[model samples]
Target chain A: MTIDKKLNGTSLVIALEGRLDTMTSPQLEEELKTSLEGITDLTFDFEKLEYISSAGLRVLLYAQKVMNKQGSMKVIHASEPVLDVFDVTGFVDILTIE
Target chain B: MMTLTVKAHISNLSMVQDALGEWLDSIGCPMKTSLQLQMAVEELFVNVASYAYGEEEGDLTLSYEYEEELSLVRITFRDQGMPFNPAECLEQEEESTRLHVEDRGVGGLGILMVYKTADQVHYSYRDGWNILILEKKL
Candidate 1:
């Protein structure tokens, strides 16, 4: 997956393209780890993201936890399959989706 | 029925998905069903690769069959790594989903999803091989 970042001051928006599975999630996790410092607003754009596995969800959860303490995080343009996963795993209640 | 065997490594996930996706497509499986099956396969395959052999190298064989009459697909994973039964993880599936974010652990959610999404899942260890079978109705 390709992660495109748009940082405007403290707000950061990440747009993802392609599948986010076991092999790819670590890339996103590492990106978030380095990019989240001092950022108060984080948004994920999933319009181009095709697939997400549990590994992907774990990364989202980690980001959410960090944002919960520092600021806020939300997901946008999530596909139906991704939404279904969130609903089934109960992440729908934890993460803000738009 | 078709079978493919590859090294149990994280990098091989895409290869597995591509091969299986092709098969599913050739069989005229619905897009949603194909996606779910692929997700389940990734979870099981990653579980085996991450924990099954620890630092040692191993291989996994994936076999799949499509029952045209019933519109069902069955996928199986066989490995010689340590014995682990994914089917039994269903017991913790519900509790894991209900836990709050602060209290929620990340490890077991993958297996929980496999159980929840797959129509049927079975596990067995025999002849020094761990066998996991997942069935989904298309």
Candidate 2:
């Protein structure tokens, strides 16, 4: 999946427009690494995202951990399949979604 | 009607992944399936890269067999690392009762994704090695 970043004050909005899985998780990680310092709020947009693998969840967890220290993270527009992934992993409770 | 195989050191992940991605493209896998495969490939291979060698370099072999008529691609990740199958981990409670974020971790999400994403995942620890096979139906 392609990850694009936008910084709005304390919140960091990462819009993912592809698939998140094993191999690509590192790419997302790299993207976050360059941008994650001192950020309080995080937003993830799964608008064009099609799928997420366990590897992807691991990456999300890392991001959540980072945000937890400073702020909160929100995930928006999770598709049914992707939502199923969150449900299976039980990450729904940890994240904010609408 | 095609077969591709490559065995490389764990550090060359991108080169190998790009090759596999190219092969998948040639096989005409749908975009969504392609992304899932890519994620699986990265996760499985990275696990081997980090945990398998441990201050030593080990070999990783990847093979793709295409069944054009069936629209299926079977990717096998073979490694000489410690025998570990992320799929065998127990499922966490649907409602977890933990107070700390530390409880959140070392959880079974990675392996769960493997089982959830792949159509079939076969794991066998034989011949002194670990073999994880991932299948995606296009």
Winner by DockQ:
1
Docking quality (DockQ) for each candidate: 0.76, 0.36
Which DockQ-derived CAPRI band holds candidate 1? medium
Candidate 2 regions with alpha-carbon error over 4 angstroms: A1-12, A16-41, A46-56, A65-71, A77-87, B1-10, B90-102, B106-108
Candidate 1's C-alpha runs over 4 A off are none
Instruction: Give the per-residue lDDT of model 2 (tens digit) for B71-117.
Output: 77888877787888675463452323132454676444555556667
Candidate 1, residue B123: CA error in Å? 1.4
The residue-by-residue lDDT of candidate 1 on B87-125, one tens digit each, is 667668777888889987776688878987899998999
Instruction: Report the Cα lDDT for residue A58, model 1.
Output: 91
Model 2: colliding residue pairs: A21-B39, A22-B39, A23-B42
How accurate locally is residue B21 in candidate 1, as Cα lDDT from 0 to 100? Answer: 94
Q: How many residue pairs clash in each candidate?
A: 0, 3
